[model samples]
Target chain A: MNSMTSAVLDEGKVVLETRQLTKSFGGLVAVNSANYRFIERQAHAIIGPNGAGKSTFVNLLTGHFPPSSGEILFKGQRITDFPAHKVSRLGVGRSYQKTNVFPVFTCFENCRLAAQAQLPTSMRFLRPAAMYKEVNERADWALDLCGLKSRGDRVAGSMSYGEQRQLEIGMVLATGPEILVLDEPLAGMGKEESERMVGLLKDLARRFTLILIEHDMDAVFSIAEVLTVMVNGTVLESGPVETIRASKAVQDAYLGDGAEAY
Target chain B: MSRLPRSLSILLSVAIILLGAYPLFGDVLFPNKHAFLMQKLTGIMIMAVMAMSLDLLVGVAGLVSMGHAAFFGLGGYMLAMLSPEYSAANLWVVLPAALVVVAIASAMVGYLSIRTSGIYFIMVTLAFGQMGFYFFNDSKLAGGSDGAYIMVKPAVEILGVSLLNLGDKRTLYYVGLGALVGVYLLLRVVLASPFGRVVSAIGVNENRVRGLGFDPVAYKLLAFTIGGTIAGLAGFLAAIQYGFVNPATLSWHHSGEALVMVILGGMGTLFGPAIGAFVFELAKMGFESVTEHWLLPMGAMIIGIVLLLPKGVGGLLLQLFSGRSKMEGGQ
Candidate 1:
């Protein structure tokens, strides 16, 4: 068993790993010594209360914020200082907590732009957009996956709030990333929409490594294979869903009376 | 209504073709009046090229540059300065030289200016344009504030075989029309390509585009360079058309006029800027003929157009043809 552990460590099975990742804003430390690992093709949930630095942590991981200290490794390669575009091109895709999308563009155009980014010749200026068959195919597939295939013609700005959120996920998926870091995918979602998103997350977990940051305990617990709880810019607990559910510290701090409801 | 109509594209192509061939049979249609009209046509064509170039930056790239006229004037100044009275410059030599110089200058200016966005981008560009204006205004090397007049235009001479005469009004008119058509076709190809999509994406949301694995800065910078280069082409035509170069060409007022042309024509449409240029020039000429205080009527007309037609002439045309109030698929 010890030999197997060493071999797994040697092989670097963890797709994304952060060692002592830290971030500070003026005097306040947003993320302090955040050492985390996300394994391949697994669903990991980062759950915490408001102001718990969960969003800051995601921002650091995506290079939207420079870490105060520590290193980040993706597949054994250090990517601590990689810009968001470079990180994305390295097969790490993400969706914003806010429903951030190309509002002025059509849903199809939004996905198509994302899909085009994944292609080898995205910078080619002479070739027409219609000539890229694979890019369009990927966009179509993503739109269908997000239940937005029929609404592809509609302008994204005109879409309902729930539909816009769905389009956000569709865009991320279209980029053809190996790892998906979704920030509050279910925020402001109604019961039916949340249920639909949960199903989509579960399906996505089977194909791509997903790191979901969410506050909804029920949704997180249902879709998460591994859970990492954070509070006050530090990890409270990290383990399987059942173990986290039974933890006394988590129950007292975050779950409160909602633990029994779950 | 719902989709970009197929007939619109056909109509645009036909319109462009007719405009190009108009000068060919201009004499037959207008009789002796062709020479007088061709002069106006040449001016219209040059301004159209500049306006279209501005639209590339404003419409597609979402970069509102207020110093675009700097590039236009710089191109004209290059020809005027280089081909002084001592040595008359050849058309082949002067044109490429001006393009190269403007390309380099634009790359430098765009590199610095594009670092800031929104209103900052506008301000930075305005500063650069005024700097160019002042530089020319103070320098006696290019005839100082009064500006320099090109004694001789760039003559097309290939191995002592004269092809096109720039001295002839009709030939110059044809050349200007040809250049406009070339620039239009080139932009059409670019807008249909992947780079154009990236530019469009940046316009919508730069951060989202960055998250999708494309650097918005690079695409925006490329667009700035392209826009600048086309404006330079317009400047080259202008210098040849007027046989002069002036500081006023690089003024912020000219830049504002170009923006007005773009907005009045239609923001993102390829053909809109050209139409805007035509309307603007024609309006000025027509109004001047009618009254001494033409600015009053002209300003009112422009304001009316802006208020009544939010999408400008192009959008109105689109709505008329499609028979729909809501025009879908912007650009």
Candidate 2:
């Protein structure tokens, strides 16, 4: 009750807070003693070099797998032990690093399946799925939000790579999540696709909290309000985007001379 | 949403009509040995129903269940056990009872088996079938290895006014036809439902389903349960046709044969397996007449079909008639 009240009223408070979160695979400590408090409705970005465990950290935060030790609190509720679906039920939507959508289904159908997950159950057996106007509307809303409104009838597998990537984000949007964790949403897109995605991300930041893992420094600087740089599974630097960008330590250890490209 | 080309759709309609009218016109169609052909067609229809049921798991859900015949056997055994020793049992009563029992049993089996996938899933289901076989084979209460009998068969009666009688071979044949059509329609309805859409999506890619927050396990378990209950219906009809139930009914071989029928006909297209079942049974009969060692030639025939037609017989028909690529089964 207390957490719910706080979550509703306090806009400045953290929406997703993880403490001492650590995960190890055999001898490799992929995420080591990491802590992050994501402010409600803020677009935060996590950036790192390859092998810094950005993807693994996203995996833990989304409950794709359980952490070896730690607690993940959402809206002040301890959800460390929750499974992936349960976490989704609590309104944490995550898009994969790779494009993931129901390939055989139409783009609208793909989002509808995600929207249906918000219901108590899909045990809905007899009446055809098309009759559910609300689900269809939600699916439409997702497609519209992701700029794929015209492609609702096209089979997802038959779609272009950029459109499928948009559909992936659209599916997450349909789930009606409070937080969006996107892993490399622009991994393989050309400049045109990337610009459109950045526009979509900016539009999304107004309504929901976003945690993005991006390698494109141009997109990172334009969209993210704050930046956290990770190195060897530990937070090496974090602050306002410009502050991190200008930091001498950040530049020496990770960003180095390459950040000049930005 | 999945529309087969116009040519294939017409063919499907014509096939259903022919099946529905076969019994009525059997005398004129196969005048030389109408009775013999009727019996064979009836058997094929029963096997087709069973094959269609397993397709829910194999084709739509992309789950390979090797113990599907266990439900088939259980359906037959349930009928035998429910019927009284002397007079015919109430069809309305025993049919529902057998279905309910089979539903619960399959739910349990699905719960255990759905946890595994690929080869592990196949082996687990096969093991479950073997367990059922051994249990019924050794138990004296079930008449041991010799099996049990219905004796009088079931009849549909409303306040003693008889609607149908199973003892009449003609009546039984019609009932089997109804069962075949009813099961087919029910599966079609389910495949279009929200629950079913998620299931097919899981078959295509479970990782994406999970990303969308749909529990793959729940959908799969329900599908397995439904498939099992429908297979039970087929088994009940088979038992009534033979008036007997035996351990062999639930054997692994039956599961393998049903799987072959599903794959040979076409996996996803529901009509394919039904066609496959008719073709398989008829071909087996044809081979047996030519030689006693029909197994050797039968093996060669299946391999040749599978190799030549990668999508099975249904794929060949679709390509020849519609000139379309692989298409989904439902509307």
Candidate 3:
């Protein structure tokens, strides 16, 4: 598909733009100066080897940790210094590499909380939250999207690894972000589960903007319209799948070193 | 239409009604010997309010404060200092003034302490409580370590006729009971509110709360301040009931005692701390009457309870009720 067609398919419009965003831990730089843009309504993938500072980039973009120096714009507004939640509300939602969820809460309650975040005020005391129709409806919608409708009452911690990963994504989606950042949505899933997840993710891209971080080459190639390859916290290459696949440098730096092992 | 279980609700309402009418029945039930029991019950009710306030932060918000008693004691001392004569003549002026002072003090403490989390939060609160304790203990102007005595009880006047005499044991019992019920209802309202859900969510996962477009720190600070204010209210009533105030009221041990009460009854349940406070105080009183080594038995009981009942008394009761429901469903 052409870039415009891909953009139209994904409802987001240049939701996140970063210029020379950098973060350092003491003398060692975790994420060097890098410029990137997540276009409106597209499944953009960022693939890199270990220690490529991909997580750091996600952290800086999401306001998990402040950047040393750079500019980040969300929906054309500067949000470099906004706290994590503020960035999220600005239409940038992210899922963690490590599953972060409310373990004790049921799957339904977890999603309900995410839905509740968008409410005008979470400070309304004197009314039962469960009785709120909007919250329940939205939470159910999220559960349906994540394919966890039947497991709504199950405690989050009790879900299988694959289901937990799907729930994590669902939790992020529940926040209704313009740009949904999935930090390895298929990290530890088996073959069938991974294929199922890719199909689900592809379906999601039609309705939402997605910035996917993945090490799974086949999945990335099949789903991503634009692929950005990173090595040591800097972009090695960026282009269509055919262009990236043809690049010898990307192969040598990332794939060539035991493509079979990965 | 089917409703939620009625038995627990019925039991709660019956308990509240019986407690409300305790003053009227005390004379008939116990004859000339009801005064002491009534006074002790009132004291337990006051402590319950204080425990409930602490639970808002510790149990619901996942903030373990070791110095909640500082706010409680500060409330009492503020009232005593404001009413130097403790005369019933100007209770209208004294009570509100005391509450305002305590609220401000607790708010300041919460604001400063909330910046730190985990052990740091606990330590900072403890430090503040100690500072408050020493400040009162060393200051002779507010009667110092010797403490101050209430020469007169504050009376509630309505159209030239007082609804109840503060000096009367029955009247004080009703007042204490009223505070307990009012605080319980208010807390229940808060728990059911969106803000309370956010606070509970923060306890469950701070990062997720933030990811949902909330500043967790801001919510936590708000919860801490509100909890402190409620504790201060309890302190205000405690001083009036006792007719005395002392630096010991703000001591670290008092704060520790409150924590124990929250844990003993159950965390996160509204009435858990109240139940804990009542049982704890009664056990302490009864144990002490039997032996000088009461603390040994108390310590053993706490350890046993912690090990045997991880969810506290409230959770166990919930389990039992839910279990019974399931069995009935099978039949």
Top candidate when judged by TM-score against the true structure: 2
Candidate DockQ values, in order, are: 0.76, 0.74, 0.67
The better candidate by lDDT, 2 or 3, is 2
Ranking by DockQ: 1, 2, 3
Q: List candidate 1 stretches off by more than 4 Å.
A: A1-12, A260-262, B1-4, B24-34, B84-88, B323-331
lDDT of 3 by residue, B1-331 (tens): 0021466557667888988887778889999867877999999999999999998999889999988999999888877877747356467877778777777887788889887889999999999999999999998857999999877877678777887788888878888898999998888878766687789888878878897788888888888888888888888889988989999999999999999999988888767788889879989988999999999999998888879988677656555555455677632
Which residue runs does candidate 3 get wrong by more than 4 Å?
A: A1-13, A257-261, B1-7, B21-33, B84-86, B89-92, B323-331
The residue-by-residue lDDT of candidate 2 on A1-262, one tens digit each, is: 2344324434487889888999999999999989988988899999989999899999899888899998788888888877787788899999999988878789988998898887788888887777788888898999999999999989899998999999999999999999999999999998999999999999998989999999988888889998999999999998889999999998888787767553
Candidate 2, residues B192-303, lDDT tens digits: the string is 7889888888888886787677778989999999999999999999999999999999999999999999999988778788888987999899999999999989999999
Comparing to the true complex, what docking class would candidate 3 get?
Answer: medium
lDDT of 1 by residue, A34-104 (tens): 99988888899999889899999988888777799998888877889988888888899999999999887
- CA displacement after TM-score superposition, residue B127 of candidate 2 (Å): 0.5
Cα lDDT tens digits, model 3, A1-262, are 1122222224335667788999899987878888887878878999999889888889898999999998887756778999998888887889988888888778988898888876876877667777788888888899999899999989889888888888898888788777888888888899988987999899888888888899999888888888899888899999877788778898888888544656
Which docking category, incorrect, acceptable, medium or high, applies to candidate 2?
Answer: medium
lDDT, residue B239, candidate 2: 94
Candidate 3 chain B worst ten-residue window by lDDT: B1-10
Poorest stretch of ten by lDDT in candidate 2 chain B: B322-331
Give the winner by lDDT: 1 or 3: 1
User: Candidate 1 chain B: minimum summed lDDT over ten consecutive residues — where?
Assistant: B322-331
